[model samples]
Target: MTAPTLFSPLKFGAFELPHRVVMAPMTRSRTAQPGNVPTALMANYYAQRASAGLIISEATQISPQGQGYSFTPGIHSAEQVAGWQGVTRAVHAAGGRIVLQLWHVGRMSHPVFQQGHAPVAPSAIAPNAKVWIVGEDGLGGMVECPVPRALTLPEIQAIVDDYRRAAERAAAAGFDGVEIHAANGYLIDSFLRSGSNRRTDIYGGSIEKRLRFFYEVVDAVIGVVGPDRVGVRVSPHITQRGMDCPDMVATTLLAARRLSEKGVAYLHFAEADWEDAPLVPEAFRRDVRHAFGGAIGVAGGYTLDRAQAVIQGGWADWVAFGRPFIANPDLPERLRQQVPLATPDTSTLFGGDARGYTDYPRTA
Candidate 1:
């Protein structure tokens, strides 16, 4: 079977993309520290890769309490929203579309980012993950995540309101769309899995209750941006974040069906990419396709060949690249031309200046 080229045009909601390659949201932690706001340099960085069919911005914290690391941009502040305006304008000026990834780290956080307050989650349980925090000397390193304070019912409702406000802020920042970052064991992901959500309230317990928080959030955000301009990201295979609950698969599949019923733009799943990670089962893919009527996207360490295979097999509508897009601003053209690939310097992947960022030279 002949596979569609990476440069093939595709439909993402109401937008018609020039190609199907997407820039996956990656946390670079490069925003200005004092304000945790986007910079002109960051604008230049995303503009360089504006050729992608869609560019999902780095995870931006929805509120100050939602922050988990140093130097991460936020969507809750005026300065941050203005800063993102430049990013969206740059991408649009370069003839591209962009989506803001709304994030709340939940229990995957340290007190440093939370202003001495413990991170909040659906339950008081911990994820046993290390979060990056700046020490007294201003050097960033991983610190143990503490057991979070369980959010009260009212607090949970307020958080959903925060998601709505963040979506409105994203629109005010001139973004074409918004993506709910419910993946990778964040706040929403914590609520979806039994491993973390052992609560007895309406927000936990049965699978239906576990997904209540997610549904409320989706409904709130959709009210602001409309379902056509909205998307949700989910990861059903990540165990590193202590999210491997017994019902993880069933829960995420149900989440997909519910999102589809709501008529959102698309569903994106972050496949496990570890060296020996288990592949996403074909059965899961078939069920996901049948359960969701909209387009589906897959993101991970996908190469040209594997990406082509997935598209050819009709399993995914687009392939989002992470590390590759870090160094290859013109990734779509690079795949189209079959040229030499550039490697990303792991050292500068996190918080840093433009040294390992916009400085990466693009191929003509």
Candidate 2:
């Protein structure tokens, strides 16, 4: 039998995807200031790229406390929900499927964004990472992350409730589903890793305890949105940002098994795409396939050939592209026609106007 190609149609959760090219979630930090609301410009940006099988919207904070970076949109308020409604309506009008990526950036934050309070984490540990903070001069710069306060049990429960409310707001905003941002050294990631979570309470210690917060958030989200509408993004191998945990792979496998039992729609693996980053192990992929029977998606520095190869190898059901989608809104079509892609301006990637966000040209 001929193997499935990247252009093959497949059923993903509640949507019938026309292809397997997914737009990976990206944080552009271009939301409306003073409220972090999604603007019409941002709606236009997503609407232009609605041809993909699926577009995972940028990482959005669940509440004021979840805001780790400057100008990232939030889903906790009425205005924010209304703002997202416009974006979702635009995407759906263009015949596309999009989901919100719920995020909380644990210790990967600065006090400037936290109302003078320290960021919260599984333990009182500081990530050796920096976050982008925009100064009063309208310039954005990377600021070092400081030691965070350990989240108490009640506070942890509140965050899980926050995830639930976020999911509720996502559905109200007309999203097709939601992707839990449990990766990239974020809140959930810290709770899942031993290197960052040194607590001896029920929220830490062994792998089971370490996963308590993650599972709670997942269950809370699923309660609001059914399992079929839930997908999780995990980065077991991307060990940067003080996330170098030796037991991460094993922990991810366990997560896969448990998620399989929960019947979540998909599991997305966020791989390190840098030139010198280590390659994801083939054995780990095979192991994940065995553990999680749901659809799998992977994102990294994937070219057309690489994406097709992985799908044909039965490692992933879909392949997500990040930077490619930024500059080439019609990315799947460009890959289909074998056209050259336009490179995105790195300078305008974070906080910018239409010059780079919505002004990228498509082939004539």
- Using lDDT as the measure, the top candidate is 2
- Candidate 1, 1-364: lDDT as tens digits: 4566667788867667788899999999889868899999999999999999999999999999899988899999999999999999999999989999999999999888778889999989988799888777878898899989999988988898899999999999999989999889899999999889999989889999999999999999999999989988999888777898888889988888888889899888988887898899889888888888787899989989999888878889888999999999999989988898999999998887898898888896
Give the whole-model CA lDDT for all candidates, comma-separated.
Answer: 0.90, 0.93
- The Cα error of candidate 1 at residue 179, in Å, is 0.5
Each candidate structure's count of clashing pairs: 0, 0
Q: Which 10-residue span in candidate 2 carries the lowest summed lDDT?
A: 8-17
The residue-level lDDT of candidate 1 at 329 comes to: 93
Tens-place lDDT per residue, model 2, 1-364, is 8899999998966667999999999999889878999999999999999999999999999988888888999999999999999999999999999999999998888888788999999899899999899898999898899999999999999999999999999999999999999999999999999999999999999999999999999999999989989999999999898899989998999999999999899999999999998998899999999999789999999999999999999999999999999999999999999999989998899987888899998779
| Clashing residue pairs, backbone N/CA/C < 3 A, model 1 | none
Candidate 1 structure, TM-score to reference = 0.98
Tell me the spans in candidate 2 whose CA falls farther than 4 Å from its real position. none
